[model samples]
Target chain A: MDLLEYQGKQLFARHGVPVPRGGYAATVDEAVDVADGLGYPVVVKAQVQIGGRGKAGGIKIAQDRDECRAHAEAILGMDIRGLTVRELWIEEASDIASEYYASFVFDRAAKATLAMLSTKGGMDIEAVAEEDPSAIARLHIDPLLGFQDYHARRLCFEAGVDADVVRPVSALLAKLYEAYVAEEAMLVEVNPLIIKQDRSVAALDAKVTLDDNALFRHPENAELRNPSAEDPQEQMAKERGLTYVKLDGDIGILGNGAGLVMSTLDVVAQAGGRPANFLDAGGGSKAEAITSAVEVILSDPKVKAVLFNIFGGITRCDEVARGLITAFEQIKPQVPFVVRLDGTNDQEGRQLLADANLPNVHTAATMDEAASKVVEVARA
Target chain B: MSILVDKDTRLCVSGITGREGTFHTLNNKRYGTNVVAGVTPGKEGQDVDGIPVYNTFRKAVDEHGANTAMIFVPPRFAADSILEAADAGIKLIVAITEGIPAHDELRVYTHLKRLGDVRLVGPNCPGILSPGKANVGIIPAAFFKEGNVGVVSRSGTLTYQIGNELAQRGFGNSSIVGIGGDPVPGSSFIDIIELFENDPQTELIVMSGEIGGSAEEEAAEYIAANVSKPVVGYIAGFTAPPGKTMGHAGAIVSGSQGTAAAKAEALESKGVRVGRTPTQVADIAVEILGG
Candidate 1:
C-alpha cells in the first residue's frame, strides 16, 4: 500500500530519519495555521499517492499565509492522475545546497533488497537509469548480513556526495534502511534528499509502499489506509476479504486464482469483450464468499455481465457452483452471468448450475467459450 | 525422471490437519504420490488419511525418511514452515500457502538460497507434479497425464488450463511446476528451466509467464544460451492496465517494465514459440511434440 507523503514522513521520523517539519491538514484554514505555526515559506504539497505531483500542479510553495491558503484550496480538490487531493502536507521549506536521490527497493532479479543512491535527484530515476546508469550506485544488501555501516559508506562515496554531507547522508541512509525493514516496506524512496546549508541531510520527499501482506504485523500502518483513494467496490471487496480491482469495461470477472483471473481478462478481450474489473475469489472460497463477490460486482452498475471462470484446485467447483447459486438467490442480479467450471468436482458443479437454469445464466465448457459467451451476452 | 518430483519423492505434508492440507494430501495420495508423513504442531501422533502426523518437520524427516515437504500452512506461518522444512533437510520444499509477507519471503528466500541444496517451488503456488509418479501441493491431479513435455509457470490455474489443454491434445506433461506469482517468489523460471533442460525424460518445455518483473526475459536468455529443448511460451496480462496489480501481486506493469509484450518479444527473439492465448500455447506445444 502506498503511503501519503505525510504518512511516509511520520514513519521515517519514527525511525530517526530527519524529515522537514510538517503538519497534515484537511482544510484550507488548517493549512494556513500550519504554515503560520511553521513560520512561513512552507511547501503546500498535495497528499496523493501518485507521482509527478509538482508537474500536475499538486505542489506549491507558499511564502505567506494567503498563498498557503490559496495553494491549499487549489490543490485540495484538484485531481492529480485521477486521485483527488483531499489532504495537504504543509512542510517547512528546506534550504537546499544540493539534491540527491536515495531509495531502498526489492531487487526482484537478485531476490534481495537494494539501496540505490544517486547524485542526480529531483527527476525521474528511471530516466537516470536509462540515460546515465553510472550516476546511480546500487548496493544490494544481503538479508542475512543486513545493511552494515560499510555498505552505507560505500553508497555515500560511490554516489559522490560532497564530503561535508557524507557522514550525515550515510547516517540517514542507515536510518532509512532501518525504517524500510522495520516497516516491511516494498519500497522506501526519498527523492531529492536535500542537503541544507548547514550540511545536514534530510528527506525532502517520501514515497513508501508497505507490503500489504505484512500489514498484519503492523496494524498501525494498516490503519493508515485511506478509503477515499480506493474505488468503493474495491474497498468493499477488501472488507469482504476478496481481491478486486475496478476496471472500466462491462464484463465483471470472477476467478479462483490470480493468474487465471488475469488470463480470464485477456480471454475476455480476446473474445471481443472489455472486462469491467479483475476479481479473484481466491483459493478455497466458499459459497458465502462467492456470494459476497457477486454482490460486490453487482454493486458496480457498469458491469453488464458477470463471468465466473473457476479452475478448482484446492477450491472445489461444486462449492463454487453452490456459491454462485446462493448468490443468485440473494442478489437477483439483473445482468447475465457466464459460468465456466473446470477441475475438481467440475461435473457436479456444472450439473448444479445447469439444474438451477436461472435466467441469463450461461455455462460454457471452456474458458474461450465462456469468454465468447459472456462477451456476446453482454453486448446483446 | 521428471525435473523436481518423481516416483521416488517421499512427500510430507506440513499443516496437514488444516482444511487445504488435508484435502490436497488425500488428492496427492490418490494420484499415487507416496505421502509418507504429515506435520502439524500440537497435533502430533495423529493421522491424516493414514499418513502419520508429527509435531515437527524434523520428525517427519527423521522417522518417515520424507525427502520432499509440501507446505499448506497459513500465510503468517508459511515462512517459518518453509524454514523448518529446510532446517529439517528436506531436499525439495513446495509451499502451497499464499499471502506470505514479502519480508518473510525475503528472509526464507535468503536463508534457502544460502543453504544451496534445498529447492523451493512456491509459497503461493500449486506446487509441482509429475503425472503417474508423484504430486505435491494443490494442483488437481486428475488434469495431468504422464508425458514428456515439462511445464513451469508463475500461476496456478493458468498452468492447469494449459496443462489440461495439452493433455486434451494428447501432449502429456513430464512434470508441471508452479513457481508462484509473488514479486519475490522462492523459485524462478531459470531455476526450473535449468532442471527441465537437464531432465532426461523432458523433450520440450512449455513456459507460462505473466507481466511483472524480468524473470521471463531472463529465462528467455537462459533458454537461448543453454536450453536445447523446444520451448513454447504464453504470457498473460496483455490487456492488463499499467500500475494495476492484476490479481497477482507481481503481475503489475510499472512504466515500461513487466509488460507482456516485452516478455513475449524476449522469448520470441530466443526462438521460443510465444503464444497470445492459452489454446495457442497448447497448440504450439502439441505441434512441437506431435511433429
Candidate 2:
C-alpha cells in the first residue's frame, strides 16, 4: 500500500502542506509539456514506490526542456527495485537552505502513534540513525487526542526548526496527521521537508503507506491498489481471499492460522529450509480454501516442496486432509509434500491421508520431523 | 476459579440476530456457557435459541445481570457495541469481530481506559472462558479441560493448539483468552497478565504471542516486576523476516522493536520460560509445575 512520491505529494497538497509546483507525466511529450509549463531549472523524479531512486539515477535536475525530456526518457522505463518507471513528476526546483525529516507511523514499542522528526533530512535517514541516533526526535501520540498543535510545535522546536518556520511546519504536521488518520495510513513521511532561504518550509519528498484492512471504508483508496505491483502468486492468493506473502525461497508453507503458520515457518527455517511463501487458509480449512491455497503455492515455480502444517482447533484436521486430497486430485502437485496434522480429529485426518497412499506425500509425527522431511525432499 | 468466565459466570451475546452472532451463541450455549441473554438493536423481546434478546446491553444487563458480553457485531458497529457494553456496566466485554477501523478501536480503547474498572478483551478476538465448563467464541469445544494452567494468546487457532498441547501433556487450562490480532485492540497483554497473576486457580501460565506490537515486551516487563506464577512463553513469527506484515491486520513490524527475537529476548531476560514449539511450551509448563 505504499504510494509513489508523486501520489504522496498530491495527498500532502490536499492537506495544505506546500510542495514545489509539480505535474506528473506518463510520456516524453507530456514530460516536455510539463517542463515547459514549469519553466527552466526543473527537477524530474521517477514515480516508483521504492526508495534509493536518487542513487539509482531515477531523479535528475534539468535546466532546459531538452534535458527534461532526456531525463524523463531515461527514467520512464528505468528499473529501480524491480519497479519500472511508468511516470515522472516534473516540478520547479526549490532553493534549499536546510533539510529536515519527519514521519508519522505506528510505534509497536509504545503501542502509540509515533512521530519521528530529525534536523537531518535529505540524506539516508537510516545512515543518520546508525551514525548519530540522537539527532532524531521521536514523540508518541495518544490516538484519542491525536497529534495536537502543541505536540507538533514541540516536535518542530526539538527538531531545531527556526521560529520563522515552526508555525507553518507545526500546522503542516497537524494536517499530515489528519490526512494519515483519515486515509487509515500506516505511515506518512515527508523526507527532506526543505526550508527555503525565505524561511518557508515545504515538503520536497513524500512517502505514504496505507492500511489495507481499512480500505473497505475508503473505496477510492482501495481502487488505487495496483494488483500489478504485487507478486503474481500473492495477487492470485488475494483474489481467492487467502492471506499470502511471497518470500524468496523454495519451501511452500500452508497453515490455518497466522500464528501457527508463522511458527511453522520458523520451524521450517530452523530445520534448514527456506520458506517460499506465507499462506494462511484461515479459520475455515474447508476443501475449497485448502485447494485454493495449494493451487496458489503450486503456481510459484520456485517452490521446491510443499509443507502442510495444521494445528487444528476450530479447523478440523479431517477437513484439511479432505482438502489436501481433493487438491491433489486437481493440481497433481509436482513437488514433494510434507504434512504435520495435529489436534482435532488428527488421527482420523492421518488415517484418511494414509488411505489415499499418495506418492510424494510424507506424514511426520512432529513439526520438526515434518520440516526436516520437507527440507530433505526439497534438497533432493 | 478461572481467570475470566467459569461455569457460574453469566454471559450475554451481543448482535445475536446476525448470522455469525447466532452461530457462536448457539455454540456457546450448547457448550455449557450460561448465556442468559442476547442484545440486538430493534430485535428486542425475541428469543434466540430460547435466550432472551434485548435491544441494548443495558437492558440485557439489567434483566439478566449478565457480567460478561461476547460481541459479534460487524466491524463498522463494533466500536459502538463495545461502548454500549462498557456503559451498561458489563464487567467484561469480548469482541470477536474483525476488520474494525483502527480509529474506532482507539476510541473504544480510550473510552474503556477512562471507565477504569471494566475489562475489554478484544474487538477482533475469540472470547475467553474456563475450559470444560463455560466455552466462548469460536474455539473448538472439545480441546479444553479444567486444569491449573491459564492460556492467553493473540490468535484463536494458536490458543486451541496450545490448549491441546497442554492437555496432551496432562496439564489442562484454568482459562484461555484469544485476544485477537488487531493493532488498537480494546484489551492488551498487560490486562490479561494481571488477571492470570492474581487468579489463584492458575498455577502456571502459557502466553502465546505473535510479532507486531510491544505488548509482549510490556507483558515481559510486567512479569519481571510482578507475577510470581510460572510463565511459559511461546512467541510466533520468530523466523519471519523483519518488516513483513503478518496475516493479522494489527501484525506489522517495520522497525527494530516488533521482531519476535526482541520479544523472546525480553521475556527470557525476565526469567520467564520461553518455548520454541508447542510441545516445548507444554514441557516447560509441566516442568515448572512439577506435573
Candidate 3:
C-alpha cells in the first residue's frame, strides 16, 4: 500500500527522522489555519497517491494566508494524473542549501535490501539513472547484519554526497531504515533530502510503500488506505476473501488459482473477447467462496457472459459446481456461462452441471474450448 | 535420472498433522513417494497414514534417515520450518505453504544460502513430481506419466494444465517443479533448468513463467550458455495490467520491467520456442521431442 506524502512524513517523524512540520487539511479554511500556525511560506501539497503532482500543478507555495487559501482552493479539487486531490498537506517550507536523494528497497537481483543514495535530487530518479548511471550509488545491506553506521557512511561517500551533509544524512538513513523494517515496508524513498543553511538534513518528500502481506503486524497502517482508489468489485471481493481485479470487458472469469485465472483471461482475449474481471477463488475454495465470486461477477452489469475455468489441485471441482448451482439459484443471472471443470473430482462436478441443464449454460473440455465458447456466446 | 526426486528419495513431511499437510501427505504416498517420516511439534508419538511423526526434523532425519522434506506448515511458522529442515541436513526442501511474509522469506533465503547444500523449491508452490516414481507436493499425480520432458514453472495450475496437455499428447515428464508464486522464490528457473540440463533422462525442457521478476529472462540466458536440451517456453500475464498483483504477491509488473512480452523476447533470443498458448507450447515440445 502506497502512503500519502503526509503519512510518509508522519511515519518518518515517528522513526526519529526530522521532517518539515506539516499538517493535513481537507478544506481551504483548515489549510489557511494550518499555514498561519506554520508561520507563512508554507507548501501546499496535494494528497494523492499518484506521482508527478508538482508538474501537474498539484503543489504550490504560499507566503501568506491569502495565497495559501488560493492554492488550497485550487489544488484540493484538481485532478492530477486521474486522481483527484481530496486533501492538502500544509507544511513549513525549508530553506535548502542543497538537495540529495536516498532510498531503501528490496533488490530482487541482489536478494538484499539496497540503500541507494545520489547527489542529484528534486528530479526523477529514472532520468538520473538513464542519463548518468554513475551518479547514483547503490549499496546492498545484508538483511541479517542490517544497516550499520559504516554502511551509511560508505553510501554517502560512494554517492559523492557533500561533506557537510554526510553526517546528518547518514544518521537520517539509519532512522529511515529502522522505520522501514518496523513497518514492513517494501520501499522507503526520500526523493529530496534537503540540507538547510543550518547544516541539518531533513526529508523533504517521502514515497513509502508498505508490504500489504505484512499488514497483520502493523494495524495502524490500515487507516492510511484510500478505499476510493480501489475498484468497488475488488473491494467487495476482498471483503469476501476472493482475489479479484476489475477489467474493461464483458466476460466474467472465475478460476481456482492466480496463474490459471490469468491464463484463462489470455485465452478469452485470444478468442477475441475481452475479460470483464479477473477473479481467483484461490486454492481449497469451497462452495461458499464460489457463490460469493459468482455474485460479484454478476454485480457488474457489463458482464454478458461468465466463464468458469477451474483446474482443481487442492480445490475440489464438486464444491465449485455446487457453488455455481447455488449462485445461479440466488442471483438468477441473465448472462451466459461456459464452464470447464478438471482435476480432483472433476467428473462428479461436470456431471452435476450437465444434469442441471440450465439455460445459457455450456460446457467445454479444454481451456481453448471454454474461451471460444464464452466469446461466441458473449458476441451473440 | 530425475533432478530433485526419484525412486530413491527418502521424503519427510513437515507439518504433517495439519489439514493441508495430511491431505497432500496421503496424496504423495498414494503416488508412490517413499514418505518415511512426518514432523509436527508435540505429535511425535502419532503416525499420519502409517508414516511415523516426530517433534523435530532432527529426529526425522536421524531416526528414519530422511533426506528430503516437503513443508505443509502455515505462513507464520513456515520460515522456521525451512530452517529446521536445513539444520537437519535435508538435501532438498519443497515448501507448499503460501503467504509467507517477504521479510521472513528474505531471512529464510539468506539462512539457506549459508547452508549451500540444500535446494528449496516453493513456499507458495505445488511442489515437485517425478512421474511414475515419486511425487512430493500438491500437484495431482494423475496428469503425469513417466517420460523424458523436464518441466519447471512459476505457476501451479498453469503448470498442471500444460503438463496435462503434454501428457495427453504422449509427452510425459521426467520431473516437474513449481518454483512458487512469490517475489523471492526459494528456487529459480535457472536452478531447475540446470538440474534438467544435467539429468540424462530429460530430453526436452518446458519452462512456464509469469510476470513479476526477471527469473525467466535470467533462465533464458542460462539456457543459451549452459543447456543443450530443446527448450520450449510459455509466459502468462500478457493480458494483465501493470502494478496489479495477479493473485501472487510476486506476480506484479512494475514500470516497464517483468512483462511477459519482454520475457518471451529474451527467451526467443536464446533460441527457445516461445508459445502463446499452453496447447501451442505442448505442440512445440512434441515437435522437438517427437512424442
Candidate 4:
C-alpha cells in the first residue's frame, strides 16, 4: 500500500527520522488554519499517492494567510496526473542548503535491500540514473546482516555527501532503514532529503510503499491505506478476498493463477480484445471463489464479456464449472461467458457446464481458443 | 536423469499436520514420490497415512535418510521452516506456501546463499517433478508425459499450460520446476537452468517469466554464456499496467522497467526463441527440437 506524503512523514517520525513539522488539512480553511499555526512561509503540498506534484502545481510555498488560501484553493479538487488533491500537508518551510536523494528499494534480483544515496535529489531520479549513473552511490545490505553504521558511512562517503552533513545524513539513512524493516515497506524513499542552513538533515519528502503481504503483522499500517486512489472494482474484489487488478478494455479475465491470468490478458489483447480487469481465484480455488471472481469481473459495467480460463492443478475444473453456474444463478449476468477447463477434473467440469448450458455460455478447448471466443463475443 | 526431484529423492514434509500439508503430502506420496517422514514440531510419533512424523527435521533426516524437504507451513512460519530444512542438511527444499512476508524471505535467502550447499525452490510455488519418476508439491500429475524437454517457470498453472501444450503436441518433459512468481524466489531462473543444462536427459528448455524484475534479463545472459541446448522463452503481462501488482507480489512494472517487452527482447537477443503465448512457446520448442 502506497502512503501519502503526510502519512509517510508520520511513519518516518515514529522511527526517529527528522521531518519538517507539518499539519494536515482537508479544506482551504483548514489549510489557512494549519499555516496560521505553523507560522508564515509554509509549504502547501497536495496529498496524493503519485509523484511530480510540484510540476503539476500541487505544491506551493505560501508566505502569508492570503497566499496559503490561494494555493490551497487552486490545488484542492484540482487534478494532478488524474488524481485530485483532496487533502493538504502544510509544513513549515526550511532554509535549504542542498538537496540529495536517498531511498531503500527491495532489489528482486539480488534478493536483498538496495540502499541508494546520491548528491542528485528532488528532480527525477530515473533521469539522473540514466544521465549520470556514477552520481548515485549504491549498496546492497544483506538482510541477514542488516544495515550497519559502517554501511551508512560507506554509502554517504561514496555519494560524496557534504562532509559536514554526512554524519546527520548517515543517521537519517539508518533510521530510514529501520522504518523499512519495522514497517515492512517495499520502498522507502525521500527525494531531495534536504540539508538545512544549520547543516541538519531532514526528509523534505517521503514516498513509502509498505508491502501488502506483510500488512497482517503491521495492523497500524491498515489505516494508512488510501482507498480513494483505488479502482472501485479492485476495492470490491479486495473486500471479497480476491486478488484483482483493474484495467482498461471490455473483456473480463478470470483465471486460477497469477501468470495464467496475466497471460490470458495478453492473449486476449493479441486476439484483438481489451481486458477490463485481471482476477485470479488463486490456487486451490473452489466453486464459491469462482462465483466471487465472476461477480467481481461483471461488477464493472464496461466488461462486455467474461472469460474463465481454468488450468486446474489444485484448482479443479469441475469446481470452476460449478462456480460459473453459481455465478450465473446469483449475478444473472447479461454478457457472454467463455469457459475453458483443463487439467484436473476438467471432463467432469466441462460436462457440468454443458449440462447446465446456461445462456451465453461458450465452452472453449484451449487458452488461444478461449481468448479468441471471448474477444469475438465481446466485440459482437 | 531429470534435474532436482527424481526417483532417488527421499522426501520429508514440513508443517505436515496442517490441512494443505497433509493433503498434498499424501497426494505426492500417491504420485510415486518417496515419502519418508514428516516434521510438525510437536506432532512427534503421529502419522499421516502411515508416514512417520518427527518433531525435528534432523530426526527425519537421520532416521529415514530423507534428502529432500517440501514446506507447507503458513506464511508467518514458512521462512523459519526453510532455514530449518537447510540446517537439517536437506539437499533440496521446496516451499509450497504463499504470502510469506518479504522481510522473512530476504533473511532466508541470505542464509541459504551463505550456506551455499542447499537448494531452495518456491515458498509460493508448485514443486518440481520428473515425469514417470517423482512428483513433489501440488501440480496435478495427470497432465505430464515423460520426455526430454525440461520446463522451468516462475508460475504454476502457466507451466502446466505450456506443459499440457507440449504433451498435446507429442512432446514431454524431463522435469518441470515451478520456481514461483514472488519478488524473491527461493530459487531463480539461473539456478534451475543450471541444473537443466547439466542433466544428461534434458535435451531442451522452456522458460516462462512475467512482467517483473531483472531475473529474466539476467537468466538470458546466463543462458547465453552457458547452456548449449535450444531455449524457448515465454513472458506474460504485456497488458499489465505500470505500478500495479497483477496478482503476484513481484509482477509489477515500475517506471519503464521490468516490462514483458523488455524481458522478451532480452531473451530474443540472447538467441532464445521468444514465444508470445503458451501454445506458441510449445510450438517453438517443438520446431527447434524437431530440427
- What CAPRI grade goes to candidate 2? medium
Q: Write the per-residue lDDT of candidate 3 for residues B1-291, one digit (tens) a residue.
A: 788888889999999999878988998998889999999999999998789999999999999999999988888888999999999989899998888888888888998888888889987999999998899998888888888999999889999899989988988889999998997898999989998998999999999999888999999899999998899999998889987889998888888889989999999998999989998999898788776
Q: What is the C-alpha lDDT profile of model 2 across B1-291, one tens digit per residue?
A: 887787777888888889878888998889889999999889888998799999998988889899998889888888888889889999888889888877677667767887898888876777887877788788777777788998889987777777877887888778888888988776777788788888888898889998887889989999888888888898898777666777887676765658888889999999988998877888888788876
- For candidate 3, the per-residue lDDT at A74 reads 96
Q: Whole-model lDDT for model 4 versus the true structure?
A: 0.91
Distance from true location, Cα of B111 in model 2, Å: 1.5
Please give the ranking of all candidate structures by DockQ, highest first, separated by commas.
Answer: 4, 1, 3, 2
Tens-place lDDT digits, model 1, residues B184-244: 8888999998999999989989999999999999999999999998999999998888877
List iRMS for all predictions: 1.3, 1.8, 1.0, 0.9
Score candidate 1 by DockQ: 0.77
Please report how far candidate 3 places residue A265 from its true position, in Å: 1.6
Of the two candidates 2 and 3, the one with more favorable lDDT, higher being better, is 3
CA-lDDT, candidates in order:
0.89, 0.85, 0.90, 0.91
TM-score of each: 0.96, 0.94, 0.97, 0.98
Model 4 iRMS (Å) reads 0.9
What is the per-residue lDDT of model 3 for residues A197-313, given as tens digits with 9 covering 90 to 100? 999999999999888777877889976766327677888888888889998999999998888898899989999999999998988899999999999999888999999999887
Q: Which stretches of candidate 3 lie over 4 Å from their true place?
A: none
Clashes of 4: 0
